[model samples]
Target: MTAPTPRAILEYGLSSGNVGLVQLLGLCPLLAVSNNAVNALGLGLATVLALTATNTAVAGIRRLTRRDVRIPAFILVIAAVVTSIELAMRAWLPALHAVLGLFIPLIVTNCALMGRAEAFASRHDPARAALDGFATGLGFLWVLLALGAVRELAGEGSLFAGAGHLLGLPGLELVAAGYPGFVPAVLPIGAFLALAGLVALRQGWRLRRAGAGA
Candidate 1:
């Protein structure tokens, strides 16, 4: 919550929104869409857009919005941005939109967005709020991309398969034959396992960093 310097904000977003690290605030989409790279990337991008827009809006209106009603105001801002994004995705990326389904609209409820708006955006200037939102979104996107790649590779024996459907490219899909498919990697349980491993790795890195600093 203490997002000050640009570097600090970046680190905060990266560590907190790691999806596998300390702040697992937004898991619904993370777990659901992470089964494939395209879906993960799509959702991640949407979240980034939402967070950035909402944060900026909230920051700009902080003085106008009263404290008691700020949360609702923030949600409304986020919902508007998310709705616009959802519509655009549905029109242009219909296949990906359908796959994301209800979760696409549900980005309104993502705590990470609201949390940043209320805690960071409301107090910070527009510039800082935007930076924080983008940094945080990048963090979330990083996790999604990594998880998606891992699951897609392990479960489908291919990487970025059917990417053309999302990218509008005819030959974007690629395949690898060597991966003996593991069905579990694409399952919900697999998400948990993969996230756990990622969390452990992050914690270990932090410990090493702390020791070196000491």
Candidate 2:
């Protein structure tokens, strides 16, 4: 097979590394803030911004950074970008900033960000590096949204609770009363169980599809 193009590299990063599904990076905020869709979306957006900025910056300076010091330089760059994002979030989206809490700053330490910077951005052109970051970030966001939906539905018997506050759109509320239980969808244990179940379900679906194709 011919060598994969930069665009293909990015697509693989998103679908394969899969900060949520495969690599399982950034699980702390994934489980914690995912109690609600708005919370998850807020963090996911921040992460995407941080990743894109870091990747681009790193790519731009890759030529100047020496091989021995590249890793530290990459981290410093990522941290600076994440800090800027954190400050912006604090200024404009204070409520979301509050809900996200430490995780906002913690994006600096997220391996997924650093990994992309070191593995992809350092070796690729700026455009491709940025695309890789965007793809990976989007993949991460998708899983966070799905997890938030499942948890919110099970925990509160509703989807998008308090969504108006996040979306800043009026009269867009979804609520379902008579909720049975919240134990399996709000707790840390619940997060683990839910994630495990999702993995198993995906595996089963893949297996079934394979069998059908055969």
TM, every model: 0.93, 0.91
Error of 2 at 7 (Å): 5.1
Per-residue CA lDDT of candidate 1, range 36-127, in tens? 88888889999988888888999999999998999888888998999999999989999989888998899898888888998889999999
For model 1, the stretches where C-alpha displacement exceeds 4 angstroms are 1-3, 16-20, 170-172
lDDT score, residue 165, model 2?
73
Worst 10 residues of 2 by lDDT: 164-173
The whole-model lDDT of each prediction reads: 0.86, 0.82
What are the runs in model 2 whose C-alpha is more than 4 Å off?
1-3
Estimate, for each residue in 126-162, the C-alpha lDDT of model 2 and write its tens digit: 9888888988898888888888888878887877777
Model 2: residue 46 alpha-carbon error in angstroms: 0.8
